[model samples]
Each structure stands twice: as structure tokens, then as C-alpha cells.
Target: MDNFIGEIRLAGFGFPPKGWALCNGQLLPVNQNQALFSLLGTAYGGNGITTFGLPNLQTRVPLGMGQQGGVNYPWGQAGGEAAHALTTAEMPAHTHALTGSAGGATALGPANNLLATPAAGALYGTGTDVSLASSSVGPSGSGQPHQNMPPYLVINYIIALVGIYPSRS
Candidate 1:
């Protein structure tokens, strides 16, 4: 008659039988979909993020000029863009605790540096850039493995995971 007692059950030692439904609980991994996606966002015989992640740009900057964001004629500007493209304003609310330590992680390079720019011609990161889409961090920011990233800085590792949800499902 009690809800707690009714929710407890142990199945026979075999695969779930057809027509039997498994009650849902909290999903184990925060990014459970990652299991279906590879490091590149593809899985189960599907095209990966590499194939669908980037937006087609007709105006990819010429060989040189002024800073065109990351493609301004410096480092190829890879590895750190896809994640910081959007602002926490656009992310889901934070509901968990943090799992890692940015500890003292600080933003490197200037706001004008190409590597610090998002490939979509956006200016943003865990650093200060007026044009940043999601330019803040800290335990109170937004979605995090556990807690929101620290404010005023974008830890290096979190910046890395932003792009590839990297799943196997």
C-alpha cells in the first residue's frame, strides 16, 4: 500500500520479457545519448556531428584582412569552438552538482585571439568578450556535469566537452 514498497522489484535472471515494461528511474549518465554517438557525434550507422555539426558558411573569410573571429588567419581554431558557441542563457537550468575541478583554471589568450573564437564567427568562451554568446561560468552558471561552472571563467576541460557529447548509443 506504500509507494516506496510498491516501487521495489527484482526481475528473474534473464533479459526483459516482451510485453513487460520497465519502470523508468533517473537516467544513469547525464549524457546517456553519448553512448550512441562517437567522439564525432555519430553512431549506430549514422552520420556524425562532423557531418552535420557545422553550419555552411558562404562568406568564409578571404586569406587575410581583419579578425574574422577564429578564422582570422592564425591557428586553425579547432577544439574549443562548438561548446562555447551558445550562451548559458540558452542552456537548460542547472540541477546537479559538479564533478571536476577547474580549481584555478583561467582564460588564456586575448579576446582578439582566433583560437579563442567560436568557428561560427562568434566571439565567446569562458572569458570576457562582449560578444560572447555564453560568456560566464561558475557553480551558478547553468548546465554542468554536477554544478554550474565557476563564474567569470570557463574551465579548460568543460570547454572541451562542449562540442562532442561523444556517445555510443
Candidate 2:
């Protein structure tokens, strides 16, 4: 008997059915579980360079932060610290610092000079001094808070299908 003459009916319609099985050329029920997962790891499609899809095997995968390696993507840092997703409490706190500059040796005496250094012992918005190297600015060196940021994960993989496979119960 010729295998091509066998009937191949779709088990389900519309969205891809979970564990949907497709028959090989022989009309035998194919393993849906193995078939779907095998689609992963293989590149979906892209420029075949820095931009490519990752194998998506898990049902639940985060879809965020995809930066091309050779592009000017805003990845926090490279080969840096691994930071977990920030919770609400870990977000940056907002603060407005008084900003101004006085040139004279004498201190200003009114509300206009609220940000000025009143005396030797008075300091507002004062904290530890940060040291900056000449190379720290511009495209020469790392910027402020010079430390590694949390590693970021990028998601660019997707799995969509139609039809279904009959359960093997």
C-alpha cells in the first residue's frame, strides 16, 4: 500500500492544540511532546548574527530585554554582577538636592543662599565625596556608581501552532 494515500486529519482546529500529534509519512501518530520541544534550540529566523531567537521549551518564559551584541543596546553592564529583578522596595528613591555655587570666602546670609555652605561645621545634602578619574567621563571609561549591574535576560522565542493531536489514553 502507498503511504501517501493514507488520510491525515487534523485533530483540532484554530489554535495549536496542546500535545498535538502529526503523523510521519507512514500515517502513524507522531510523538507530539517530542516534536514540539524539538522545534526549540533551532533558530526560528533572524539575521543569523547577534540577533536570533532562543530555544523556548518552558511554558512560562519572561519576554523582556533583548539587545543585539554588536548594536548600541542599553544593557546595564557586561560580565558584571547578577541582580535579580528589583522589587518595589529596591527601586531608586527620589530626592531633590539644593544646587548652587558661591565664589566668595564669606557665607551668604539669606534665603537665596539656602544651598550655600553657611559655616565650616554646617553641611546640608552632604555625604561622602565621590572620586572621579579624568577618564571616567565621556566614552573613555565607566560612568558613576562604577560597579557591575545585575545580569539581564532577553526573551525572543515564541511557539505558536494550530490543530491538535488525539490523546493516547
Candidate 3:
């Protein structure tokens, strides 16, 4: 019998103003707000991580992600919060990303091989410190996504997650 876990989402994002970090001579922060996370979820999941950057990508100051493809994507603003797309790269890093629906091999690492960090390619981040980042909700770069981590998600699960709000509303 073959079973599949719908989606392994790294939702519920919140953090302190630990402020930003300087990597590769770039200054960026780790903590983010709910709204920004929302936009990230939309741009990343809605528009397809493969396309449609955030809203306020242009206004991004690019504190440090220049070396790792710093391209700001924008979003619509409301109130004082800037309508910017929280760079996917800023997230804590996908510590244990999923592989696929069927759930691939278990290498004593991430259960889902599909979302795990890459062995080689554009090793983005803020410095020569190439480390394995967590996926349980994190931040992105200023101008662009940190690395094309090939975000993983189950459509139905995401829809279900969004459906919760509509139903409540």
C-alpha cells in the first residue's frame, strides 16, 4: 500500500526584532511579521515559486544578498507595512524539506528529498558560511530569493490552508 502525505508546510511565521544580519558584506534580518509572511506565501505558493516575485521587490534596499541574486520583488502595501515580498532566501532555511507526495528516501536528514538543500549550484546566503538552513518558516533576501531551493508543497494542502481563512471569514 502506497500512502502520501498531502503537504508538509512550514507555516506560522513570527520572530523577534533580532534585526538583520550581515553576510558577504550585506545586512539582512531574520525576524519578520505576519503580513510579510502572508505575501511570501502568496508570491511563493500562489504565483508559483518558479515565477511572480513579491510586490515591493523594487524598494528592497538589498542589505546583503547581492552576491546571491538580489532582485527585489514588490507587493501592494497597506497601512505602514511596506508591500514587499519577503525574499524566500531570508527564511530560516529549509532544515528538513520534503521530497514529494510519496515521501522519498530517509537519509537521516530531511524526509522529503525534494526540498532539501542543494549539493552544488548557486550557493547563496550572506557569506562563505555555507550551512544547512531550516524550512520551518524563515525569511528571504532583499532583492531576490536566496537560492532556487525548489520549494516543495502539495497543492491540495495549500488550498486547504487558505480555505481555512475563507471559511472563517
Relative to the true structure, how large is the alpha-carbon lDDT of every model? 0.31, 0.35, 0.31
Q: How far is candidate 2 from the true structure (C-alpha RMSD, Å)?
A: 15.0
Cα RMSD to native, each candidate? 26.4, 15.0, 26.5
Which regions in candidate 1 have their CA more than 4 angstroms from the true location?
1-66, 69-72, 84-141, 145-169
Error of 1 at 111 (Å): 47
Which ranges in model 2 have alpha carbons more than 4 Å from their true place?
1-32, 42-69, 72-108, 113-158, 161-169
> Candidate 2's C-alpha lDDT?
0.35
Go through the candidates in order and give the clash count of each: 20, 4, 38
Q: Could you give candidate 3's per-residue lDDT for residues 112-162 as a string of tens digits?
A: 445434455433466676556676455434573233334443221111111
TM-score of each: 0.12, 0.20, 0.13
> By TM-score, how accurate is candidate 3?
0.13
TM-score of 1: 0.12
Residue 65 CA displacement from its true place in model 1, Å: 8.3
Residue 54 shift from truth in candidate 2, angstroms: 10
Quick one: best lDDT, which candidate?
A: 2
